[model samples]
Target: MRTRALLTPLVLAAVTTAGLTVAAPPALAAGPDISVTNTKAHLDQLQSIANANGGNRSTGRPGYKASVDWVKAKLDAAGYTTTVQSFSTSSGTSYNLVADLPGGDASSVVMFGAHLDSVSVGPGINDNGSGSAGILETALAYAASGQTPRNHVRFGFWGAEELGLLGSKYYVGQLTTAQRSAIRSYQNFDMIASPNVGYFVYDDNAVGNGVRDDFTAYYDSKGLPWEYIDVQGRSDRAAFRSSGMATGGIFSGAETIKTSAQASKWGGVAGKAFDACYHRACDTNTNLDLVALDRNVDTIGYMVWRYAAKDYGTTTPPTGSNLLANPGFESGAVSWTGTSGPITSGAGRPAHSGTWKLWLGGNGASATESEQQTVTIPSTAATAQLSFWGRFDTAETGSTVYDTLKVQVVVAGVTTTLATYGNVGADTTWVQRSFDLSAYRGKSVTVKLVATEDSSAQTSFVIDDTALTTT
Candidate 1:
């Protein structure tokens, strides 16, 4: 659940097609609408995973690993590259899964992510399976259309988020300085299908406001009204903001009781919490409001395509050559090795722009998932940059702590930690992060993304859109 904050000033902004809202490129006319039926199908799978494993996909549990495997398999079949990253905490080890699509401007990246792990007490279908399924369906729809975009897109399925924010933090800490700068924006969806739902948008910062506005515009376009809610640091967005990255996302409601006004607008029980089954044993697939899930998932698809295909008039288009081969995982994880756990490909979630991405962790307990690629830097190059987009969702329960994701440079036998992440608490959005590799100019170095879990009951981490450039 997200921590609550005072609502900021509500400013409803209209979506304009003129100057503010950029039109989609010729290559990507109006993107395909996501299928609500398909999104609900994902939720069904998650529920099945939980039922078959332990009645709950809690971190460090078999159900969690099963959930990750199910999602990865779907993404792989859809032509996306995926990776599984591992992290540890007092509860135990956990994982994060990241998927990337091939072929888009790597410089300007967009991301969307959701947490796949649930609390120990329940299936957590409405609490987060709603979001996970919504994003998953959107990714699959993108793959089915086979459309190209102007910006890169990535998707992340986080682990151990209910415990704290371990997985997402680890992912953020592992980015190279150059990678962080390439990300254009990150959007997150947490509890979008609560039984007694409300259309609440995160309105805390400029980035958040923009996301809220986009959602509001979507609702307005459908003749629906939305209210603003400030979740200051309760969820995954907190991890992005901690690293000075722009972040935004949506949530329905958690344990907070709805008011009569909200009931009038959204039509649910006025005094009940948006999700009375939140974190409880009854948070099964049956706990969701399908109408809410359908609408939010559609909105998710619309925003993802809008950001990925439209020219936001920001950074210049990428030019110079990339030093690393298969930088975007478009080539099916070529020139890379899984040093520990498995790294694969899939079309499971929104990517920076292509049809694939490399995913790490989400396997099981006490896992050490990692992948590395060796790149040679030209001697004449004065500066080198390593960039990528990443998203993570982690958790901590009780006294358990410690889950990590690391980006490191290995030259000869020595490994230097370029970035390190642990216990980010919550961040459900993709952020572009980068690290300077100038010191490795004129040499061959192994760039690695490592996910480590301390014990069990931890979370997950994800990464994509990798690029190494020297000029």
Candidate 2:
């Protein structure tokens, strides 16, 4: 969980035609490395905007509104539902930008937030531009990924945070009880790119929920040392934590003196403040640790992807004569035997007919994921056909067969790969794939879809609208 974007990649190519240049959309990264270049580009925008508006985007200031407008425009263009929530402050009126991915369970929302406002004294690049730009790029990348999530994903850019977290407090104060409860998890990020950074995950023990575990695990996986920091009643997290929503996030230390041991572990000055600039005029683009900025933004992207497909292992009872339980995944992950997070009702990709589908692979790493169900065909049936609609999207090209989706059959625990689909011809159209099930009549068999991908690039396999019919 972390914060801030809108899109138009930094290095996108264009075909110029007499001052009418059309820029091509940049190819999206599979996950995590959702383009550090894009994140930095967003920070560049924030820096320039601050420069044009009195060196700061403090609450109720012209630069703050410009920041909100800029981020909203990007999200709007990328298809997120954007809203500018205005609140009154002592100075004047300030704004918060909220953006949501279109689909996912409305009852449970996973949110990533960062304060967009800086202090009146400086540009606040590392103080928060790191976080703001990080989240914005993450949002834009999610829009480009086209994988719908299981839980609703929202991004918030708050206002007046430097003024004692007033913006987030005000925003939460306005939510109805039901609306507040709906935001099941909130992750706050502030000052993530200190010049001398210390990776710290929020730990209130009672309010972090399990998000801290995920955050710690991610750090461990990367071999990055991290420590738990108490952020309760501090920063924007206080607003959500006090509202009964579970809260957690990471903070690169701000204004704290670096200890000798911490320096040895994380590498930087031995005793200087983690972020020497903190909120001063020197807190410009030059004050950032680009390495920390890239890594944290990548982590932000990873977390968003994780929560988007998070499944709580609950499902609805099978209905109708389809012979498959929760075939479309609309009722969560009912009757599914493989892969914990693939059955998604996300709106990023079109389902065959409904709001849910079985998604596998596209993690951008060497991975395999699948979904399966077991059923017995009646012996008396004259004909039995197993069919489903499937669609595919990929970052791999040119027929080398980097990723593959195998439709398999398991009879008496003997697995057989029935058909193998690859990235070369896997289009975004919903095409029917069928296999005769007459051979398995009077016997129980497991129908499975297994997707495998190499370490680079991603290929997503989406399946839905299944039926097993006999007459």
Top candidate (TM-score): 1
lDDT of candidate 1?
A: 0.73
- Expressed as tens digits, the lDDT of each residue in 1-471 for candidate 2 is 112222221121111223454344333334567687888888889999999999988887899999999998999888776656677888789988878775565545789999998888888888788889989999999999878576768899998887778888877886655467567688888888888988888875687668877777677667677777775455688888887788889888876688777787789998898888887899888888889988898888878998888774432222224555456665555445455568877776778876888888878899999777665566666767888898999998797999999998887768988899988887788899888888887766678889999998888888998877676
In order of appearance, the predictions have TM-scores of: 0.66, 0.61
Best candidate according to lDDT? 2
Per-residue lDDT, model 1, residue 267, is 95
**TM-score attained by model 2:** 0.61
> How far out, in Å, is residue 294 in model 2?
1.0
lDDT by residue (tens digit), candidate 1, 368-452: 8777766556667778889998776665555345677889988765899988876555365888998989888766577888888
- Enumerate residue pairs that collide in model 2: 3-135, 4-135, 4-136, 5-136, 6-74, 148-346
TM-score of 1: 0.66
